[model samples]
Target: MVVQKSPQRAVLWGCGPQGSEVTVYVLGPTTQKKQTSVSNETGMWRVMLDPIEAGGPYNITAASTNPTNESVTLVDVLFGDVWLCSGQSNMYFQVSQIFNASKELALASKYPHVRIFMADLVQSETELPDLANVSIPWSVPNEKDLAPFSAVCWLFGRYLYQILKYPIGLVESCWGGSAVEAWSSPTALKKCGLDYMDEKLMGPHANSILWNSMIHPLLNMTIQGAIWYQGEANTNYHKDLYNCSFPAMIDDWRTAFHEGSGGQSAIDFPFGFVQLSTDIKNSTDDGFSDIRWHQTADFGFVPNFRMKKTFMAVAMDLPDSTSPFGTIHPRDKQDVAYRLTLGAQVVAYNHILTCNGPFPFLILPDKMYVYIIFDQELAVTPSKDIFEICCSASVSLCGPRSNWVSAPIKLWVQRTIQLSTELCPQSEEVAAVRYAWRDWPCDFKACPVYSAKTALPAPPFIINFQSSSGWKRRHIATDNYLSTEDDWQKMQNGFL
Candidate 1:
């Protein structure tokens, strides 16, 4: 079987101002070819081969002759899925700091499909349009390589390699103590305007500067998508600025890396980001929660082509204690990788295995009609004591009164109650019903409280924490789900 050659292209950005004449060489599966071009006025210049040439272990070397002699080398280059991994210290954490990163070194020793390109962490008061001293090259990942590549990035790349089985290139342009604005471009900031901050004169145009130094140059390459793990920097509760500003960066990069003859494909690349988690003490402050909620809300919204193609990795469950207070670095890279990998699995492979397996989404029903909406269509084995329906009392028709209940509703069944509706106080009076209503930590103690000893009739739903409460007769929506009054009744009826 003839192997399909990977797509080939070249990208050169911020070359004009850095020098007058720069010759690029493409050496892989063929003799190196040279091209002479001056960095454009914008300091951003790009070129794409009309017909992508051969692919292999390639080398891209750049030499400048603007006024002096300068040279740069990028080795072990290959045409593949190159992703730009950016964030705070979490994404910049060293691999050696992890538990068995060294022991796992053997497995990570040879990364044929994975390569890493790093940008030195640098920030300036002025947004430098053309970063002249960006000295870094792309190299294959190995334990002996960079002392500490981003821990999250390492696992993420490894996971992507295993899943796609394609060459994965990563560009890590992150800083240990930087905010979202530091990584965003001025274009985006300017667009965001002072409606938020007098950003006209902020610290540094981090995003734009980073793109200039770290990402802009690589835009000459081919990439599948990007995975982001940031927001800790902008923890000033500017989540609104972030939610709005972050998407713009995605758009800016897409615009910068157009995939056409000399432009990137107009297609908005899939951009997946990790939620900052509850690390911030007051997520409710500054409408931080709302900010995150809105940030999340924008994922698939309107005229913005950037958001429709994105996903959010939930870190709400991650341990905040992992890192000490005032500590900028959080070292739960394994889970970060796991989370991003799961997301990529869904984004890249469409491989859905479990609710937590990745790509798990909560589908909000338009209205709670008579029909019950199962977030996931699950199958169950019928049993006499399979589950129960409860309103006020601990009603058990087939088995002992249980804390959790799952009524097996047969497909197309018109029955008001699936499991025995008896002992449910007034069946129609039942204001609301809950399955597993507790934050039973998705990790460690994820097993349901009562279901562990007995065969569970259904998967847990809204996790419950405390014992039952009473509810006087109250009307519920036609869906028969619990109404707010039930909660009030439980307290007023002295059933707490």
Candidate 2:
């Protein structure tokens, strides 16, 4: 029973007026007693479930008679995690884009635990409706079932379902050519100091008002997190708004969900985004490389935003050479899904991080502190045998026996090593330090056979080194070389 400004209440549907007393009553199958009133809150009431009444298939009816109406009944409902997946064409790309995605769909068809809720695409300029379409429940994936699903979303959902094995819910709100601005709340953009750019441009409703209406209503329904694969639309014209707009989109969604859901704060949601892919254009305007660099730098901009969460699957190296140039669509989406899953594997499952290749950069100190970082965890302990900081090119270091290179850093550790930089005591003054850096055949046992030797060539302004990796000798103009993170930042700032 629900009532306001009344001292008395009864479980009757027809409560006289707004300020009248109201009460609700329902006999429980296990309720042997005649009546019980357990608790009340802010003039509102709910049936308290005694231990015996907790588990039930019982009929519940609240009686209140008032023209204003006291309450409404909610049908069958389940509580669990829900994820909101949104983006542009890549996100809208369907499973059929992948080879035999139909088979994958068939396999998923057996599991009813996975639920997908799709919010129809709508753009709005006002406050969203209180509820979105829930007529659709979680469906089993089959050829017919998967037909209209986003391919990236399908694959990502499948991978998550496979691992979590829970009641996974997916809410896909996507439009192929939609920009980031379309999904933001008009007020949210204003908060970020953006002028309202609503399609109609009538007033302040330029944000993703529709997404708020259709999707925000489902918050507190519980959700794992989100996977975003967009920026194509925003970058289509080389808009740098992403530096502020993209992250704001995420934050706004979070704010709306939490607020609409009555400020439920238990969930510490994580968001994963896909860096714009390689097929993107390189035009001076909206160039893929430029956007990619922006996305890469974004990793550092958003606190706790990890590359592991936001993956940049390098499509530049994929072997599907038969691609249409200048076209936004890439036919091979299976690999796209696979790469995303690999990234998800790291974030959702706490998988070990390893270097995709020599990354971050290796720096040689005049004395001992050579700083280096691998993209992922080191598979092997840095040892003299595996990593040697060479000074003189003539001397070769092996195991602990080598007189030159210092001991390598150990596993799960990042640090600088100290070597006696007192010029190679053997002969010609030592020149440069050698990292696992090489070209052609890199033969680390754990290294994949297909791995190509990636070597850093001597720059015209850096000390010269001789190697078979097509590295040319160049004079050292300066001793300082930009590190990986540094270089990544410069590129992000458009300095490169």
Candidate 3:
């Protein structure tokens, strides 16, 4: 029922008797009201209202053409930055399940101004209107509601609310065991000659069923942006298609949410995501690393006009060693939330901040080693044995997680980490290098690799030997890193 408060913004959607008239009145904070009417409709009506300031406790009254003469009024509504939180189970991880859940729940009482609009789990083949079938009411944070809310999303909104001093709307739109393709719009899939509704991909529901049931309904409503945490499900099966498919989906969602919502101008809203953390046991392929690469692609590939198309929070370093790589759902939601908060600060809030640890860029020396460079410039953490590496003659033979072993990390300068080509046998071509790329140790030691000054958790990366044909990938990244061979080439030449 909440529409973004803007000048001539869409306020409501209603159905009345065919060929009948419907009326709507929106009362803003200052008792200023606007009246709009839809005459002779095919039972569907979209009402627009004048703009209100960012914070509001406004009232809206809507009337149908039904002879019964019934009306609905929404009161104490505020105009604020609305964010769509979507993805799979990890995105749906609730507050009650996080570390110090009791403390987080108690602190929840401090941010009553933050509200949540939870979309119930639903799947449909056809596009649906907002609340077409399922009805979930918007509620402010309270003890009863806070426990079950998505923990990462709550913390994101909590931080934004406290700092920005605005009402933050958190829309929980997710489903466990769902794949990326499931949430993609049918229109996007078909355009790319893909089948978002592939029956095999669909599991139980029809193709694009979740998109129709979950996302379609909310398209008309404007939002500040979206935060995504998915790909564990797609880690193995969809990693290949992810590079192209993922970017296309972001494009599609931007179109649908902005154009479909009838905004005043085209807006390429920010879409930030969490990189897959280490989960070595469950994934049979190196899908985690491959997908992470694709997620960061948005940063490199998307133009500045897209308004920071993506902000990726590296979860690779924040795993629970006790659970080891065996557990998929790590209990460290606090780190996840804070990392995402930093990303939002830089990307969404337009703040100049160091949001990532030392991200690697490789320069292959003709002589003895490969020099790994970084974006923010780097210094070595006072930890040793942090660089675990691998090498091979070819991209495939070396294979992900194939022949990895500890390597001597030579910190030549603040901006570089060096791996001696000697790690490879005499005269053998060293194809690639990966650092802190394996699963976390079973012990409780923190991830040893970090950016020297900022100490932000470093994201996992691969540096390949760029060659004539392409970049040669020999270092074994991990099981799920079975991304296409060119992935290494892209990482080296394209992103570098």
**lDDT values, one for every candidate:** 0.49, 0.45, 0.66
CA-RMSD of model 3: 6.4
lDDT of 2 by residue, 102-154 (tens): 57667666745555656665555455433445333445455665667777777
Q: What stretches of model 1 exceed 4 Å from their correct place?
A: 1-8, 12-25, 30-34, 39-47, 50-55, 59-75, 125-136, 195-222, 259-261, 265-267, 280-291, 298-306, 320-330, 348-374, 377-496
Instruction: Assess candidate 1 and give its TM-score to the true structure.
Output: 0.63
For model 2, the superposed segments whose C-alpha errors exceed 4 Å read 1-79, 131-138, 198-206, 265-268, 280-286, 296-327, 342-358, 361-496
**Local error of candidate 3 at residue 330 (angstroms):** 1.3
Over the stretch 70-96, how does candidate 1's per-residue lDDT look in tens digits? 777767656656676877667777777
Q: Considering every candidate listed, which one attains the maximal lDDT? A: 3
List TM-score per model, in order.
Answer: 0.63, 0.56, 0.84
Q: Write the per-residue lDDT of candidate 3 for residues 387-425, one digit (tens) a residue.
A: 644556664555566665556665456565665555566
Ranking of predictions according to lDDT: 3, 1, 2
Q: Where does model 3 exceed 4 Å of error?
A: 1-10, 35-42, 65-68, 132-136, 196-206, 264-266, 281-284, 298-308, 321-326, 377-406, 439-445, 467-496
